[model samples]
Target chain A: MFLVKIYVQLKKDILDAQGKATKKALESLGFEGVQDVRIGKEIRILLDGRDISEVSEKVRQMCDKLLINPVMEDYDFKIMEVEK
Target chain B: MKFGVVIFPGSSGEGDCFYVIKNIINKEVDYIWHKDLIKDIDTYDCIILPGGSSYGDYLRPGAIASKSPVMESIKEFAARGGLVLGICNGFQILLESGLLPGILLQNENIRFKCQYTQVRVENNKTPFTGQCSKGQVLKVAMAHGYGRYYAPEDVIKDLNKNGQIIFRYCDAQGEIEISANPNGSVENIAGISNKKGNVFGTMIHPERSSEEILNSSQGRVIFDSIIGYLKGVTVNGK
Candidate 1:
């Protein structure tokens, strides 16, 4: 078994409105010296796989197919073996 | 001519599109459920992807729904030169489905805006805007948080060069300015079409403003344009 952690973020050029709003809220809470904030999504998937190499490639394909939109977002993933 | 309004799992605006098409426009229309793989898609002259949060706006507004089996048929429908109109959430699906250019992001202000706004007809030559005159202002209602239209600079230039930009947010008098832009869309763009002009997507909910009882029936022009185009196609033996 493997647990894949995927993080998807808007492209650098795209503005993160939610992140900006959260940043303002943080400022209102008296946080100081905050430079910037960018929000992204994290998805975790647990699946059975043959091995690390195969799992890595499968996860990448999953991200490319349905998990992330290439038009405005980029994604990366990490896979860890787990006892079934 | 027949019209089909696609209804996704969480689609809340299909009823409105169906109402406008059947009750107001007096046409043959039906709901195409999301799970159904339409085999006789050619029976319909136009297909509408209406507004509202589909799949509960999961993983981005239209991301999940764009991969549904119904969207596969929609893509096929569009490729065959059938007119497809996507409003609000529908527009997002079009972008996600790669049927249209540009992406819709959260509004710059990070708030869900629901209000009456005017959009100027930037290109009337397309099938969807033929009933409207160039520069004609339309009173429509917009309701969404992720309505900001964006694309790479080169794509924006291509859209401009190809006359794919169909509508721009504008004042009542047709002045294109920043204040009139409800959602911080690039270049004040509110709507656009594919290069072939058979497919269109817009952030504005024209169905919401389609009736006289709504106090702003200006959106009727969009429906009228589609009906006009379908009629022309029929007359031309298509």
Candidate 2:
């Protein structure tokens, strides 16, 4: 078994509106000197695979097909072996 | 001509769209479930993906619904030059399906905006806008949280050059300005069409404002335009 952790975020050129709102709230709470804040999502998945490399390929396809919006978002994934 | 309204698991706009087509527009309409693969897609002259938080907007708005079986058939339908209209969440699905360019992000103010808004018709050549005069401002209602339309500079340029930009947020007097933008879309874009002009997606709910009793029958012009085009009305000699 393998556990995959994926992180998705808006592309660098795109504005993160939610992140900006959270930053404003943070500043209001006295967290000063913050340069910038960007927000994204993290998704975890478990899969049964024969090898890590094969699992990595499947995860990439999953991201491209469904997990991320290619027009505005980028994604990265990490896989680790786990006991069934 | 027949129309099909796709209903995703969490779709809430099908009833409104169905009503508008069956009652207001007086046409044949059917509800297509998300899981159903439409074999007779060619029979429908138009298909509508209406507004709502499909799949409860899991992961992202329209993300899951875009991958549903019905979307595949809709994609094929659009490829064949069948008119496709996507409103609000439907617009988001089109983007996610890659049937339309650009992406709809969270509103700049990070708030859900629901109000009657004005949009100017930028191009009347499309089948969806043939009944509207160029630069005519139509009053429509927009309700969504992620209504900000965004694209790369090159894509925006192409859209402008090709007249794919169908609608822009404008004031009542038909002046495009930042103040009239409800969700901070780039260049105040409220709606757009694909290069072929058969696929259109807009943030505004034309069906909601389609009745005189609603105080704005202007939205009916869009449907009328479609009906006219299907009936072989040559738009701008196109």
Candidate 3:
């Protein structure tokens, strides 16, 4: 079994509409001094397999294939092996 | 050119894309479902992703549809320099598919925005916007709740430098400067293209604005731009 943590974000060049809205909300909520904010997604993927490297590759593939938007998002992952 | 339009289960813009291409642009295109497997994925010259509430916006707009089977082929196709366009929820799909770059955050106002706004053309270099001159201001109808654009300063600057900033929300003057930047978007950007200028994405509904009865002459230019690009590429074989 393997555990993978995936983090997806909009590329630096891409805009983040959600974060700005949050910032606006925080400001409206009296959370002053909030200059700017950028929001992204973090996901944890767990898999059961022997070829952990293959799983890693698959995760990366997922990032580019469907997990992330190549246009507006970027994704990275960390892997850990589950052993008893 | 054999063009394919990706159709997910909830995509409502497929017909609009087809209608615009066939009637407005005078081009016939094929419909490609999200599950359809592409033999080569590289053979097609271009592809378009239509808009809709994929997965009924569950989890997120494109969280489910991005994982559809057609994405693999689209990725391969884009890697080989194939042209692709994602509009509205289609834009969200590109973000999920990693085709363009960026995340579609919820709108600043938290309400679904469906109105006609001005968009300024920032680039005329890509196959998507080659028909218009650089800095051309266009009136496009944007209908989305999460259409604000954001990116880091350096990246935004680089995008501006590389001419990847395709469309921007503009003011009454049709200038993509300050104060008129709706949605508080960074750089007033409304649409974008990849670094290679091949893949493109936008939140506005160009297909909706394509006809004169829609109250805008702007949509035709966008279609003309893409169609012109396709024709030019087809003729030049590049």
Candidate 4:
């Protein structure tokens, strides 16, 4: 079995309003020298498979096709074996 | 002329479009549910994607609904040069489905804006705006949290060069000023069209402006323009 963790974030060039607002809140809370803050989404999936490479490819395809909007977001994933 | 308003689950604006077509404009209209296969999409003169929180705006507004079955038929209908109009949430779906250029970001103010605003007609030659004169202004209601339009710089340049920009938020007198732009869209863009001018997507809800009781009938001109184009009549004697 494998546990996949996917992170999706707005592209660097795209404006992240929610992220910006959160950063402002942090500043108000007295977080000094906080340069920048960006928010993203994390999705976890479990697959009943043994081949890490094959499952990785399938996860990438899933991200490209539906999990992320390529126009404004970027995504990355990590896969690790989980004991059945 | 026949009109079909697509109804995605959680979409709340289909009824407004249906009312505009059947009651205000007095035309043939029907609802196309999202799950159904639209085998006869070619029979309709125009397919409308109305405003609403489709699929509960999950995973980004309109993202889930964009991949629904009916959108495939919408894509085919658009490819065949049929008119497609998407308003508000509909606009987001069009973008998510790649039926239109650009993406809609959250409003700069990060608040849901719902009010009557003026939009200057940038291009009236398209089927959806035939009744409008170039530079004319129309009062329309915009209600959405994500209506700020964004595109690659090159795409913006191309859209400008090709006159695909159909509407811009403007002052009552038709000045495209930043103060009038409620959502911080690039160049105050409120709407745009595909290169072929057959597919249009706008953030404004024209259907909400189609009645005198609504205090604005200017929105009726959009529907009139579609009827006019289908009837082969030139608007403004053009």
Candidate 4: residue B38 Cα off by (Å): 1.0
Q: Mark the 10 consecutive residues where model 2 chain B has the least summed lDDT.
A: B229-238
Query: Residue A48 error for model 1, in Å?
Result: 1.1
Off by over 4 Å in 1: B233-238
- Model 4, span B59-168: residue lDDT tens: 98989999999999999889999999999999999999999988999998899998999999999998989889999999988899999999989999999999999999
Which sections of candidate 4 miss by over 4 Å? Answer: none
Tens-digit lDDT string for candidate 2 (B107-159): 99998998899999999999999988889999998899999999999999999
lDDT of 2 by residue, A1-84 (tens): 999999898999888998888899999999989878999999999998999999999998898889987889988888999988
Q: Residue A51: error of model 2 in Å? A: 1.9
For model 4, what is the alpha-carbon lDDT of residue A56?
A: 92
Positional deviation of residue B210's Cα in model 1 after best superposition, in angstroms? 1.2
What DockQ does predicted model 2 obtain? 0.86
- Retained native contacts per candidate, as fractions? 0.88, 0.88, 0.38, 0.50
TM-score comparison, 3 vs 4, better candidate: 4
Model 2: per-residue Cα lDDT at residue B140: 90
DockQ of 4: 0.72
Q: For candidate 4, what is the DockQ-based docking class? A: medium
Q: What is the TM-score of each candidate against the true structure?
A: 0.96, 0.97, 0.74, 0.97
State the lDDT at A55 in candidate 4. Answer: 96
Tens digit per residue, CA lDDT, model 1, B1-238: 8999999988999999999999999999989998899999999999999999998898889999899899888899889899999999999999998999889999999889999999999999888888888888999898999999999999999999999999999998999999999888999999999999999999998899988888799998889888888777322112
**What stretches of model 3 exceed 4 Å from their correct place?**
A1-84, B40-43, B177-179, B233-238
Output the worst ten-in-a-row residue range by lDDT, candidate 1 chain B: B229-238
Per-residue lDDT of B72 in model 4: 92
Residue-level lDDT tens digits of model 1 in A1-84? 999999999999898888999999999999999888999989999989999899989988888888888878998898999988
